[model samples]
Target: MTRKRPLKQAFALLVVLSIFMVGFRLIPFDEPRISLGNYTIEDGFQLRVIASESLLKAPVSMDFDDKGRMWVVEMIGYMPNLEGIGEEEPTGKISILEDADKDGVADHAKVFLDKLVLPRGVAHVYGGLLYIDGPKLWFVEIKNDRPGKKTLVDPVYAEGGNVEHSSNGLMMNIDNWIYNANYNFRYQLKNGKWLKEPTSARGQWGITKDNFGRLYYNNNSTNLQGDYVLPNKIIRNKYFKPSIAENKRLGANRVYPIHQTSVNRGYQSGVLDEKGFLKDVTAACGPLVYRGGIFPESYNQNAFVCVPEANLIKRNVLHYKGLQITASQAIEGKEFIASTDEGFRPVNLFNGPDGAMYVVDMHRGIIQHKAYISQYLTEQLAGKKLDTLQNAGRILKVTSKTIKPNPIPDLSKASSSQLVALLSHSNGWLRDRAQQLLIQKKDRSVIHQLIKLTSLTNSFSTAIHALYVLDGLNALSFESLSALVNQSKNPETIAHAVGLLERFSARQHVAKMKAISTQLLAQNNETIDLYLSMSLSPWLNLSEATFLPVLSEIEKKHASQGIFQEAITSGLGGKEEVYLTSMNPTDLLKKDLTTAITNRQKKELNPIFVLEKNSVDNRTKGLKLFRSICATCHGADGKGIQDLAPPLKGSEYIDGSMKRLASIILHGVSGPIHVNGKLYQLNNEMPALINNKEISDQDIADIIRFTQNAFAKAGKGISADDVKKMRDKKPSGSGIFTEKQLLESDFEK
Candidate 1:
């Protein structure tokens, strides 16, 4: 009986232990078990996790609302596993994270929206939430943290492309226009109407702006690229593509990762240094020009770029010389923030309302999209078990150690007068938000205050913001703008005033504009000169005799400068020939300008597929496919990006045999191939479209036809039958062809 009692007791203890173990596994731990010790930030700056898993999962981008709550876009379905099998599942969400207990860390998370496929961007604008859900940009009013009155802002906002190459960044600039990266159009909701206009297509992943409103963005390889001039300023002429202003690579690609990085192209020579650290930026994105005031004054205007593949954030010190903006590494061989943990993937950066920098860390193992993932990276990910890290993210706040981040103000409840006063706040984010709120309120009572603020000489950024605010409010007049132009000593303020004066460039305003132009031209200030040159076009359209002399004087003085010349040419627009005829024929600068303008005009006139009806139909279909798919890598103009793809505009491959081109397209080509005599050793393998079940034989044919017609200038195109034949002839094994193999194969059939 005693032996039997001992056995019963043992069995009871085992049963209890089993139940507890099962309960422990079933109990949900919203907070992920991640260690903060994994991070290593630069001295004088501290980084702490403010929001993490359970609160926000796979946060790619985040925007703070007027209540100072974070509206986070979680791309949860991205790269779910090594094969990305369930990535199409609509499991993504936008969660509103709040610090409920008044603690710095987010204690509660309420989902504002869910069932998103891959929502990339979000912004609090127009008293509503603007967010990107896959290809569409949507707006929804928030009532009690729930979406209401949903409206589709743009159905094809991003169109077809992988998340990495699709349009994102719903950033509202100081000009009251909402801009995006990887998109050609800017959006605005004016007087309860949605307005979109074509602008320059910018960077790949993320976009930001400086204090002066010049945008900054980056791509996979380049560290930083920015517009020298303000948005839509230089793209005035449909024919001219300004080289000096838009999409200028302002920083070098050199990178210094603290630890050995698991880059996609690590197998390629020169991708990693001798010490095994990434040699350069391979996946640079989310460039943020630091306008947060909490950082040391030296850190002001510093550009912080996210290199997720390297698990680091690079700091770049930007130097402004007149209109040109350039950047250099803050430290020669170090990073601002680095982590030993491979899952510390910082994908986007934002200046917080609290005057600190917030990093949106998609704390996942695989940062690269499956479409561009390399076999070497696949092996690396598998070897390290990085594919197992999923559904986890962190929003890290970076603040100076000596100076605490300011408490986030509830701008939603702030009065109109208070919002107006905030225009001069040291933090650019607050200043921008204040301007946006003021415009949204449509409070005409503050217009006088804003106009007065524009004339303040002490705060140039404030003045600029105030000027744009007045413009946004539709309160700016010729008298007000001219006053700023005449009274303002700050070149940037005067430059903006000059840009604003274009609205008043009628015959009545021309004489006054010419007088202002003549007076400003005498100063020879490059910034003032550039804006004056760009703005004079409207006046010139009305009275060429009055503005022509003004242009000629500015042109002769600044003829050697390309930016100035470009601006002058931009202003001339339809009067290019007139200006060229007036200039000296012997002038080399004039000859160069004439050549550029003439070539651009010719290219515009000689657009692809002005042929027969059938060819035109094929060309049209092909062009749509090319823009949606091929343009992601080859670029819209077919001039490929560095370390991304070789230029297809004049590629020997495109101009060569149709069969060869078809084969290459069906089964992708690996590079170290020569395009226009320049060797391009691209890191990512050109993916095979044969496996993409969505792309049909006809689609492939159209793409080929488009590439040949548009880029190669070939009159002929292949048929779906030809594409099928090439698909059938695809070589055995992995099916991805190397440059050597493609060159050696006989495609004569």
Candidate 2:
């Protein structure tokens, strides 16, 4: 009887195991749910992702346009949570997807932006679309309903550094004042359309405006978990009016500041629940003014409820300026959506015509709709801003205020004082502005100040401006500028000043240019050499005779550094010159010593040695032959690499020569011949002159001798008599040659 009871229990356990297995297959593990008070939501609000892949794979902010088209802004590459596996991110792109039929799946997608440098923020404004372009914000406005040209707004806002370096938000106010939210706050005044504060103002990220004309924004400096950092406070904002006329009457009036409270702070600070989990608590600013200025004067306020990060949508309305206390209400139960999905994560939010608040859910593949009791909040703010602008002009209440104009004397009228004041301004920018005004001043008193400004500061922009003024006054002299160049540390500034002196008929700057070159040689750093070389390249046009000496000096000092090699290669007008000149190959070849040839080869094969033995000399006949016969394709440097010519380095014909070289020169070999592994079809009429009716084999051998030992190889020389023996050899076209050919050639066997 006991055995029968055991068998029955085992059978029951098997039935329970099978049921649990089926449930596991139906649910994905990461999609956890959130719960509210008495109401339980069952994943209906969860994003209906089309693929099995996780939506947060490359999580970033998203945006939506007026057409309701959703765009997801993702940073490039996978975000690895583990150590040592971090890989470079692929180029980032902004994906614009549309769901025309309201189905959960995306209908079509187009690349809205590409090749962005870590671009994170995307805002869709009514005037045109704006995007985060590396370090700058660019907006493209469509023309005549067609996609329009892009305009660069202010490139950097100095909120915590350059706006380009920080991931912040751009929010538009009711008066069209664009408020830039970094970790700090900066606003554009509606009247001037300029920054309310300088680049120094910083604080907060993510910006939104309430309908009643109050500004709302948040700080991202606070937050925890993961390697990623996020601002702590859910929201922070300021209340400011944008009417210029009204603002003149009131001294910073109608501007107030506000902050949002979190759910964790409201409950369960000291007590732990019996279930080992705290009960659901929620908080988010509610009645947020979408545009500031749409309600009755007193109640025309709106607030952004800080939705608790705890997974539930908590709504609460706090006092506008004072942040007075108030009870919060729950909008949506947590279980309705994925707990990891933050609904308000995307920066853009607006109250729609359907009377429901629309939040852009970038990764979710849909626009989320929230029907709540606080929908009136946005409507009130928008109405309030409109009323303020309309009533601004009627109320002209003037207040006492004064602004000091820049101390630089206006150069438009005063000839002497304007020039002196501008040249004396403490900053380089002011000095430059003054120089321009002096161009029309025709004043002599400012010349000393201009020279002083040039000597005291090496600012390239200011020096150039001062040089122009000197030129106008006929005060520029080689002696004066050379003294300044000697003191200037910035090579570019010195170069520009010298150029001015050279153009002003200063013979002294010419010698100064050479002196500068000498000074450049003393610097050991490659950056200094690169800078000096680039600065001197322009002088090459002065006179090849003058330029050649400098080029030789550069080659002498830095040839071992590779700067000389670039200078040689870049200086050659044609390959023929490169082939014939005696560039310093010894220093370059010494590093790769194994490949360097012995002294015996150099002595025996010197163009002079080969010329005397073979009856062809490179100095006279070889140079004339090069220009007439080889210059067309080989260039002056004999580098031999033209659009059609191949480099002669390691060329088999030159290295193995006499018989092989003579046959091709005599018979004009055609068809595919590989040079450096690249095949090319030669011209059929390649005029050859081995021992042909045209010339003797002796001249041909000496010419080949000159080329073989030149440039990179400095190879062994061939005799003219050796070439005469192979005078009648076949073309040897259309086949790869073997070393045995040299042994079997008539010149050998």
Candidate 3:
């Protein structure tokens, strides 16, 4: 009996040990959900409605006041009478909603402001709310219990002094001065008005102010701008990689705009006057040139910094007050939440009450889908119990309480052993956080620790997080990544490690990425799934030029996968002209140009050209047409880039249908349209493209076909019959087309 009892105890112990070992895979490894203890999570987190909500019909941007009340900007036309208000452009008005009970749902909802003239960007300055209405800068001050709006700048001045009235992005510095991004408006704003400020770059939707008062705007281009004073001193480096710049380019893939950081002094300037109020245009960063880069290695100080898309949430060094200022990775990471939020399109970073940054994604998408808004509001109002990932597009609170970022350890004073001990801590967050801090502190002595962390199989996930830290730290080296890949046995871990490598110049990591990819492919382990090939193409490997044929075949085979297909198509779409032997890059570039030119043309012309010819023809005629007609609204190259004018090329709408096209040109699209899968509001008043009785139906049809085939290859070879059908049975001018409506249209076929 004693011997049997001992055997049973041994068997029970083995069973318990087996169960515990299997539980590691089930551990909740998601980013920690922490609470500040004082301001509950409900205080900041907002509910989003991307999938439902009818009244919120195309919510684009949102703004908040000192009282914490929110004003949502809806893209669809307003229901003034709620009985029969005809749909019209400038479908403009503002909704004021309040959550007095601390619930995410609004306790009170009504139209707070109305009759806005195509308002795009909104911000708060001093005690009033500011909005960009056409060429005028207007503000409404809240007094007693009512709101009153006043024009801060004259419409004529803003229009005549500048290129156009539309403004896409806006921001207010801590000192209270406002900066506006005039979708392709590279002009100057002087004395409460705008003027021609010529530059090679076009401004897109992002504008932010750094602590030093430098205003950074996302210039929608890869072509570097030439120096104003020293015209010949043009920097060859691309500041904003076009593939990553502007919402339209990236929106197609469901990715937001490139995250960028800039100083306020770069574009406009402000200072606290004697009255302690903010004033505009005090100084520019032009004269404050630094020789090195933005951080430790190169601090080249020049006026008007152009931030690339990759550095968003990545650590960057900026020159402020003649001192190289260091911004922590946490500051950059805040944008991830703001970027993910749907309501906050055209988001601008603002200092919140908690002394941290809060971004209000313009309520463009929110207003478009009211059902989603209702459900989202319901979930949010319910204390965020419905913590679904789809609600990423909400009002994100970046208070210090949300993210308990580790304090930066002064590695300069710490011993190597201490550094390793900190990095190898049992807490994964602590260990990863320490590795990031060490990279930033940049003490080479810690290299041994980094190398050791790379080799430890238990630290594979820890090492992946550390690589992103290295990327922000600018400590990523080809040799280092190669060493890590050699030791890595886990496929998922290695996939993340490969993703970081894609950020560097393609030429630099090609060899290492190729070798790692080759090794990953050979692994037959069922648990070893590789997502890295999604970012890989045959062209990535530089050293093995002889293996190009094999790689090309491999790329062709993998191109069928969703991720890989998207990556390759997006990459090709980004190029000005990409040439593959099987299919010429020139042909694709020409097709894009023809699509761009015809989409902008008042009347379609069959220019007897292929992609190569169209590219040449567009360089001449396209620029003129763009400036005279399209530039005033959509901007050159059909980015529909204005705060008011809708983007045409790459526009999901223009890629199909002649009905919406005819309405926009003849009657005009009044509200928001989902283009590139992101909703955009043209704000009504597009100055009717046709004098209804003048243009012939045939001409319109030709124009329709040309535009349909211009931007996306999927839209090629559309027929005029399609145009006639759209023009005949189009929706009444009651509201802009809905995503459901567009999807339901026969044109989708």
Looking at candidate 2, the ten consecutive residues that score lowest on lDDT are: 391-400
Q: Per-residue alpha-carbon lDDT of model 3 for 1-749, expressed as tens digits?
A: 45555764455445445545764211111121322232212223332321112223334456555344556665444212111123334656666654433333343344656676545556554445666554566666766325675646434213421111135444542212344553322322234443432222223334543322334443333111111111101111112111211222110011112222121122222332333322221111111112111122221122222112111111123333111122222232122232322223333333322223333433332221110112222223224332121223233333333343233243335554565565444333234334434544556655555656655554224454445445544566766776666678755445555545555535655655666656655664222222343344323334335233333433455433332322333233212122253333233334433343343353432221111110122122222333454456775334566567666756756655546555555444555566676777656555544445554555555444434433333433334465455454554444444445556656433
Task: Give per-residue lDDT, candidate 2, residue 516.
Answer: 61
For this target, which candidate reaches the highest TM-score against the unseen true structure? Answer: 1
Cα misplacement distance, residue 473 of candidate 2 (Å): 47
Candidate 2 lDDT over 259-328, as tens digits, reads: 1211222223432234333233222211133211222122222233222233322222323211111222
Query: Could you estimate the TM-score for every candidate?
Result: 0.80, 0.30, 0.32
lDDT of 1 at 423: 88
Which sections of candidate 3 miss by over 4 Å? Answer: 1-57, 77-90, 102-106, 134-136, 156-165, 174-177, 183-202, 219-349, 361-393, 400-749
Runs of candidate 1 exceeding 4 Å displacement: 1-34, 583-749
- Please give, for residues 1-749, the per-residue lDDT of candidate 1 as tens digits: 45554764455445445545654211122333456797888999898888888777899999999888888899999988764556768999888776644557776566788899889999999989999887789999987566889989998887656677778999999888999998788899977889978788889999999888899998899999999999988777666677777889998898877789788878778989888989889999999999888999999989999999999999999998867789999988889998888988999999999999999999999987654555567668879989888888899989999988888999989999999998888888899899988888888998889988987865339998999888888999998888888888888899788888888877777778877887898787888888888888788889888888887877777767787777776677777777777655236446545755786668662111121111224445676677777878897657798899998867888888888888887899887888889999989988778888888888888787767644664435777887888887776567878878877888876
Better of 1 and 3 by TM-score: 1
